[model samples]
Target: MPPGITTFAADAPTLSAANTGFMLICSALVMVMTPALAFFYGGMVRVKSTLNMLMMSFISLGIVTILWVLYGFSLAFGTDIGSFIGWSSDFAGLSGIGVTQLWDGYTIPVYVFAVFQLMFAVLTPALISGALADRVKFTSWALFITLWVTVVYFPVAHWVWGAGGWLYELGVIDFAGGTAVHINAGAAALGVILVIGKRVGFKKDPMRPHSLPLVMLGAGLLWFGWFGFNAGSWLGNDDGVGAVMFVNTQVATAAAMLAWLGYEKLRHGSFTTLGAASGAVAGLVAITPSGGAVSPLGAIAVGAIAGVLCAMAVGLKYRFGYDDSLDVVGVHLVGGVAGSLLVGLFATGGVQSDAKGLFYGGGLEQLGKQAVGVFAVLAYSLVVSAVLALILDKTIGMRVEEDDEVSGIDQVEHAETAYDFSGAGGGLSTRSTPPGPGTSPAPTNKKVDA
Candidate 1:
């Protein structure tokens, strides 16, 4: 018996078909988010490094999926082994688990729950890839994710979601994963970039995104998939909480997008498509933990603040000199911190949890708890990630060669290019020269238009 979990209901093991169907669909939606992330990060890098960026996100679906099925799930959700971690091998290989078995309090099959959570495990590490883009070796990036998730992510998941986990027991309200996913990944991004250093042309070069249209497409896919990410965290669709979360997610994201654009207009003297996309993601991060606890109006507030703050936060890398290529620390870390902390101010008792926030007369107690959870995860993830990065850097070499980086990670690492301009005369002029002395004329089969 886990310490904080109470057996209020009998172990009848009855399943709800509706909830099972809902979670299955949500799981698929969340699974798509990883590839969606690949596109998002892919289009944000220079043309040369696009495929490597996409692969960084794509590979996590493979690596984390295997780790999760084998023991990652068990280590995260297994019986409590103290509050910091779960029993590692208790459910290794998912052994001794029977079909038609229901999760303790939920109406869905335990397997359904496991698969749904697996999507989260997949996306979290991939989120850090954006910060380290354009400079890391493919093999080193793969190895880093495998180890980082094993050491940092699994234990944090336990502390936040596992029954006997300290933060769970302390009544900290993380409706989904603002703390676990966003802040954890964001801080880890900062830590690794610190250890691995910066790209060759860190501040001097103009590292503009090669494909803004692709970035928009990726952002759109992320928006579509995020509905599942937030609402599905409820674990069942039969409840009204899912509905509330769904609405809040939409409203917050919309508000954040607008707020981000407005801020950009003021600071940069014009609105930009990139600001809109980044703002949307900022809102998503902010509302992940608080959507279920706040009203539509509250959601708007959360989104608006995240939009403005993350817009500002993205500039910090330039100001502080750490080169977070994609602003992971700014958008995710800052937005996540904003959302988690605001839950202390705006949470209402009528929502998912009975905990109220400062504005609702709950005092500053919950706010303190939220801060504790935020900083604890931040500090732990930062230190551990930095240490892991240092170890990997020292031993197997974490970065690409300068020549490889200058040429492009795609050609050097994957031996494939994302776009082949070769068919288009290497992206140069399409015109052909007229027949001349001692010169072979262009193929007559191909017509040359004047």
Candidate 2:
């Protein structure tokens, strides 16, 4: 919720019911994105581990919510401690803060702000799950995130958004969470995948998505919910900044989807639905940090560039051989970085702040600051996340048994499968459909796993 405007309690504006109500609704919208993400990642895996893929994201809702209530909020947004972290007894256990107390100088209640930011904290680690899909034990994955968020997510959030934090003070403009959420999650994904090694057959198997329709559905929901994610970061409707952000969000996403389709058609000779869905998400990520500062046209330029860049980046795994099953590294990390840097080029001197971009007479200074935020978050998350993954790997174990992984994580780990066919006319019947006239019976295309 860093709106590029930091305020103190002494300067606080009286609570406005309009702003309070808007933020509450925005919180709910942001909450839906986690389950939507579960569906998106779930549909990307083979049928055998579909439930596992889904649970990887669903578990974050439970873990992070409780953590945020405990000490997570305080560590993230409390009074700054030497510009490195934040702390205050009032925020610990979410105690002593009155329900009607305003947050900073905003027109919303402290509770409203905490809950809104809670959604962001919950979604950050969930983004990492896509990279660690089939092979890890569910218990280990859960534990990994518990540690990852504590060591990596909280500190980075403070650095980027918390008052008096280094990046915040340095004027690294992230309207939403390109650095704290996307880059942090993406870098953490890379770190863990490095320690855990490749999925059993990284290069040998196709591992295509099992359900394109489900993926599209999830992507649509994410697109709908992201309006809250980006626009709501302003924390109020007191100005046209949020309105411009909303318009930028829409145009950027449309431009990115079209750009991705064009690139996919040229490169692979087909405009696949997966490319469309992935491209939409790339645009969303790219615009999250910069949308408030750029015009709609600037947003389109940012999205188009990110669409092409991320589309090309998905192949880097093949060249270097890392098993990022859902292309988290390619889309989120690269997209986050792209959106962040583009800010320095597209930001106007009007919206959000008086800071102009490179194209608008601003120099390379802002770009350099953005690089610092991007690099700091990336390096810290990558190194610490790898260390945490290695510790878990050496201790109680992080990977499932080879037999269990090679089989199916769903039935082995959860004792459940994504589908139960005994009720569906006893699964699929081998009997052929009756022929029409003299035409031959149509074939049943049986789907296979990687």
lDDT of 1 by residue, 215-273 (tens): 98899999999999999999886659999999999999999999999999988888898
With candidate 1 superimposed using the best TM-score fit, by how many Å does residue 408's alpha carbon deviate from the native? 0.7
Candidate 2, 429: how far from true, in Å? 5.1
Worst 10 residues of 1 by lDDT: 441-450
Q: What digit string (tens of lDDT, one per residue) describes model 2 on residues 209-322?
A: 989999999999999999999889999999889889999999999988999999999999999999999999999999999998898889999999999999999999999988
**What is the Cα root-mean-square deviation between model 1 and the actual structure?**
3.9
Query: What's the TM-score of every candidate structure?
Result: 0.94, 0.94
Q: Give the distance in Å from residue 225's predicted Cα in candidate 1 to where it truly belongs.
A: 0.5
Candidate 1 residue 272 C-alpha distance from true site, Å: 0.6
Off by over 4 Å in 2: 3-11, 429-450
Each model's lDDT comes to 0.90, 0.90
Cα lDDT of candidate 2 equals: 0.90
Q: TM-score of predicted model 1?
A: 0.94
Which parts of model 1 have CA positions greater than 4 angstroms off?
A: 1-13, 88-90, 424-450
